[model samples]
Target: MAVLVGVGMLVAARPPVDVLGSFGSLLQTFLPWSGVGVLVLLALAALRRSAVTAVAVLVPAVVWCSLFGGMLVDKRGAGAAGGDLTVVSHNVHDGNPDPAGTARSLTASGAQVIALEELSPRTAPAYERALAESHPYHSVQGTVGLWSTYPLRDVRPLAIMPWTRALRATADTPKGPLAVYTAHLASVRVSLAKGFNTARRNEAAVALAAAVRAEPLDRVVVVGDFNGTTDDSALAPVTAGLRSAQEEAGAGFGFSWPASFPVTRIDQILVKGVTAVSAWTLPRTASDHLPVAATLRW
Candidate 1:
């Protein structure tokens, strides 16, 4: 049984198909937690004094480390101390009771660019007013928005969803013109009857990925609620060429959902033609999702 469990862990490390109705994607989402199973098996082996079982458990332990060992290292100093630009992304819950307060927290991050998702008609105004002073230039397309300290141009909506849920624009930073994309991908759900339901999110990812591929700018930054983790193969289309800021420079897993007690990161900051010097999650706000911030160097 221990050997079989170890083998299963190794198999799961490979990209899996969604033939079992999104099971593969779901598994990948929490794949890191598989290490817990190996630990449990080791405990059982000790209780039984079974040397073979203990040795078998080492298989999965090594596999898990090989897959994620680099992340365990402290990489905050991988890039320069003051990056060229600082960006933040958050999913302020649509029903959040205090949009003003949430906006305040984001401003305190000192990010040059901030992307917000799940903005409702009523709460969006509060955010605009609160963030106006710090982020003078801003654009809100449907539920997604981008607020920037730098000037914005060529702002337009992205047709990734039926209604507006994504947008892109050019930020004339001191470093140069950078193409910025903010998107709120379709939410995913899981159930016993339908298994993990990510069809909608997957479709949105495909469309977003297409636009990103066609972007003319050499320097690009994508920030928003991706609704799926980087580990999930479903996001491969969008994450293919780009690199995740958190994965490159964050201290840990950097989970950012369910702000009360984050378990997984759905919100993301991905970059192309830029380097992430530092990436970290901000303190919880009125919103259900925590904000993720990263500093990038050109």
Candidate 2:
């Protein structure tokens, strides 16, 4: 059991999947609580007067907590006085039964810029119409879209697929041109032979990273359901230059998936050359993933 838990921890820390990207996000949803389980086992062993078992349990508990405790800190700091923009991101589950409700909830978030992924053909029009009133400038490509309060310029599609995959839009904000990229990377599904497959996700990540690296804009924001975690090796190429808004400003772990019982934050907002003042996970809605909001100062 100890060895199994240790292995699980390692897998949770670094998802072990191929072709798809769901494993890491799945593991992150459950791994943080494993330490508590270890502690419980240690207590039970101690109660049974099994000294050896107790020691084994205690050691792993301490080690695990020591390794990841800092991540539990309320990283979201108080909002700065001069934040230039506020952004929100969500997957909005393609099969969401309540598009109007989701739109209402998002509208209440008061985000100046909204990035959405998993936008199905049937629901995209509803979202576009719903947000049209406040976000006059908007752009969509494939399943990804960006709605901005400011004027959008040079809107284009990102190369995440053999065809159009993601969307990129530049907002002409008062501070400067803010380049926004929205993507719903390849979804990972379980298979018989492989525990997790992330090939397509890895390919998309590489392509996205290359595009971002070649971007001419000084300020950039990337948002969407990455289907991977900040710690996942597959995401290293993108995380190398950008800072996670939740990691910088959120309090505690910002889990945003499986809305009914969120365990991982595959939905993310990453920024470059901007200060994240505050970040937080919003309340549950009709979608499978919860929304994430962040304030940024230039």
Candidate 3:
């Protein structure tokens, strides 16, 4: 039993051959938790006094550790001195009770570049008013917006979804020009009706990935609520050339969803042609998501 389960764990990373693999991908999003399952097996093995089962348990345990062990060590990300440039990404739940308060929390982070998503017409004004004081140069393409201390140009919306949930622009930083994109990919759902309803998110990722691949700038930063984890195959297109800030510089898993208890890191900050010196998650705000920040250098 141990050897069979161990082999299963090893083969899990392979793209799903069928529906089971699709479902496995969903479970893999929280793959670290699988260690707990192995623990349960170990307990049963001890109670049964089955030495074979105990030996089997080690297989899955070792396999699980190999896949997710690095994240267990929270290496210090950035430092107090900070990086040359700071950026933040957030999905300020449109249903949030206090849009102004959320905006204040974001500005408090001292991010020179900010990307915001899920803005309705009514709440948009409050965020604009609250952020206007600190961020003088800003642009709104569809529901997404970018606010920066430096000048911005070549701003436009990225039609990854039916609505304008993604946008791109050029941030003319003192160091140089940085192409930036803020995106909210289509939400995914799993239910009895559908095992893994990822078609929409997959389609959006394809379009966004094409845009990112076509980007001409050397330094590019893409940040927002991806509605998919870095492990997700659907996001492979967008993630192919870039790297996630959290994986490169975060202290730990850096999950940033369901502010009450973050399990999956759907929110992200990815970069190319630059380094993420530090990446970390902020305290929970009035919204459902915890804000995410990253410091970058080329």
Candidate 4:
């Protein structure tokens, strides 16, 4: 029974069946929690003291280990020094209580390039005033903004969705010109009737993917509140060529959401044509989501 249940989950992750496969792909976001659920089942089996149950427990034990054990291990393998650029991405909840305090916290993070999402017209000025001192060069397109210690050029807004939640820029760093993108994809909501309502998010993701693919810059970094983890298949289009900074250099599964009890990572920093030396989550701020940061080197 345990083996059967475990195999069923494995099949869901990449079921050859169409609809079932699609639904199962969403399982990736809660993969770790699923592993825990299986462990709970193992405990029940142990309590029953059935010889067969003990053997059966190994099925999911091995299955879950094979699926996510590697990610659980510290992946901060040997890397070079903190590179020439450090970037941070955060989704400052639109209804945040203290926009000014949050701005102060984010600006204090020491990231040379900072990307903010979910900015409101009301609070945008406070952040602008707070970040202006450190980030001399900044651009706001729609609700997303990029502030850089280095000069920024070729700035423009990207219509990944109808709303102004994404933008692109070129950071003229001392090292060279690096393409940067700040994005806030459509948010998703859960309903008992529809599980994960992601139609809009998925469409926007496709648009963002096309935009990234057509970008002329060889070195590009995308930072944003992606609204879906790299683990979710829905993000494959936008994540195709880029590597996740957290997965590459963060010490653990750098979950960044729901500030207080983050369970899944929706915010992200991904890069291509560059190496990530380190990635991590910043201290909690006044927003509902935490900030994610990463250092990169060419």
Q: Point out the worst 10-residue segment of candidate 2 by lDDT.
A: 17-26
Candidate 1: tens digits of C-alpha lDDT, residues 1-298:
6667667766665545734447777777788888788889889999999998888888878888887777787677543356988999999989999888888888888889999999999988988999999999999999999999999999999999999999999999999999999999998987788877999999999999999999999999999998889988888999999999999998888988788888889899999999899999999998889999999998
Clash pairs, model 4 backbone: none
Which stretches of model 1 miss by more than 4 angstroms? 78-80
Against the true structure, whose TM-score is highest? 1
Q: Which stretches of candidate 4 lie over 4 Å from their true place?
A: 15-17, 77-81, 192-195
Best-fitting candidate, measured by lDDT?
1
lDDT tens readout by residue for model 2, 1-298: 6656666676667665553256665566456777877877777887889887876775566657765777778766555344778899988888989878887888787888988888889998999998899898898788878888999999999877786668888899999899898888888767888766777887888889998999899999998888877867667887789999988888877899889998777888999988898898888988989999899998
Instruction: List TM-score per model, in order.
Output: 0.96, 0.87, 0.93, 0.93
Q: Is candidate 1 or candidate 2 better by TM-score?
A: 1
> Tens-digit lDDT track for model 3 on 265-293?
99999999888888889888888889899
Stretches of candidate 3 off by over 4 Å are: 17-21, 46-52, 80-82
Better of 2 and 3 by TM-score: 3
Regarding lDDT, does 1 or 4 come out ahead? 1
RMSD of 2: 3.0
TM-score, structure 3 vs. true? 0.93
lDDT of 2 at 278: 88
